[model samples]
Target: MSFKVWMMEIRVPYLLLPIILSIVGGALALYHGSFDVVNFFLFMAVLLLLHITVNTLNDYYDHKTGIDFHTKRTMFNGGTGILQKGLLEPQQVYRAAMGCFIIAAVIGAYVVYRVGLILLPLLILGMIFALFYTQIFARNMLGEISAGLGLGVLPIIGAFMVHGLPLTIDCVILSVAAGILTFNLLLLNEFPDVDADVPGGRRNIVISLGTKKAAKLYSLLTFSVYGILLIFTLMGVLPPLCLIGLATLPIAFKAASLSFTEPNVGDSFFQGQKANVQMILVTQLFVAVGIVASLLLI
Candidate 1:
């Protein structure tokens, strides 16, 4: 496969999540006065590889189940359509997914070795989520929670742990906000996939609650992320500078407003998805920036 095909296969645009997630965790560690540049890079490598594994395995399983064949491929929802396009064999994608997981595990093991055994369970859980997310969790109601935990909460905690720091109260609070933000992202994206998901044996939040309620839930959770940040910042649990994350609120409101309307594969819904993505990335990026800026101001 050529470079572009490979990038498409792994959903390269979505890869930004792991990078931002790594920084969130790493910056929190830095704020606590425990940071190693080498370990931070290793943590990012593991996150990037595991994220690629999630993408490839999702495409492989979705293709095998014919979900990709039935769903409308969009910039956000649906798989990459690589398998359906005959660009890559299913087994090839499967192998690539497994390859990335094995490499991530090796690096994670090294992280554990350097950081102490505290990180072992989280590393193992991350591997499990990568391997079984599309096959198991998406079919049950656990998919959104799994995404929030694996992609959201745990990365921040693990990144903090790599600095040999114990779990602090502030870090846990910030991590939950990350998880909720990610939960909203997955919930919003599921709107267009409800029809295909029902027949595909998937029972995610949108499938369980119906799109109307799910969209409401999406909007509620999206704003609640800022609410959490604001409450904690005011309580002095988070740096007051973390309120910079709320700067994305206008974009978030537009995204949430659009979610209430029909969210089919139309231009309006696409804009909503695009806005949601921007909100997720920019909010997390600003939060990390705020934490680091607090350190400098001190």
Candidate 2:
């Protein structure tokens, strides 16, 4: 294959964006005096590799199960790539995924060596959750709960590993905010795949609840994060500036309204997915800013 063809097959550019964001988030954590630059980058690198592996494995499994072939399925924004377009074979994708996972495992092993055996159980749980999420078993109903625990609690554990201490209530609150934002993103992103998934026996949360009910749930969770942040701030568990995440509320509410109003609308899925990605990105930005502001002003 020509270099251009191989490049197209890999979709490396699309994959890099999320890795970049992960690195930026880790950098921000370091800026907030959470850890040294080296440890933060190492953690980010491991996370980025793990995420990519999961994405690739998901595509491989979806193809194997015929879920990628359904007619009504619209690709989730910048989707898992290989299965969405047949640019790569399923076995090839699986092999590539395994390569990424091996890399992640090496990094994770280093972390465990440095941080003690506590990292072992969390890593095992995270890997199990990722493996079962849409593969061997369906945990779609427990999506939010899984996301909260994995993204929120696990990251804090990673952070503590780097810092060599337990996380404070403030750090835990920030981690919860990250988890809620991640969960909401996943929930809304599933909207577009509802039709395709339902026929393919891929009963995701949106399909389980029906789109209308799912939209309501999505909205409730999005707004509830902000509400919880405010409460945390008032209770002195989190810094007041954490409410900076509220700036994204109007956009979220608008997206929620559209999702609710036009549940089966052809374009609603894509629209809602776009809005969810935006919400996730914006929330990350605001969270970083909020942490900085809190450190300086509060």
On lDDT, the candidate that comes out on top is 1
Clashing pairs in 2: none
lDDT of 1 at 276: 96
Residue 265, candidate 1: C-alpha displacement in angstroms? 5.3
The clash count of every prediction, one per candidate, is: 0, 0
Tens digits of per-residue lDDT, candidate 2, 1-298, equal 2566344444454354344344434534544566666666666666666666666766677676666665344445324544567666678777876787778778877877876787777677666655555664443467555655655556555654564555466666666666777677667766666666666666567777887788788888778777877898789676557678788887787777777755346775567666766766676567667766766763
What's the CA error at residue 157 for candidate 2, in Å? Answer: 3.9
- Residue-level lDDT tens digits of model 1 in 11-50: 9999999899999888888998899888999998999999
Q: What's the TM-score of every candidate structure?
A: 0.98, 0.84
Misplaced by over 4 Å in model 1 are none
Highest-TM-score candidate: 1
Worst-scoring 10-residue span by lDDT in model 2: 16-25
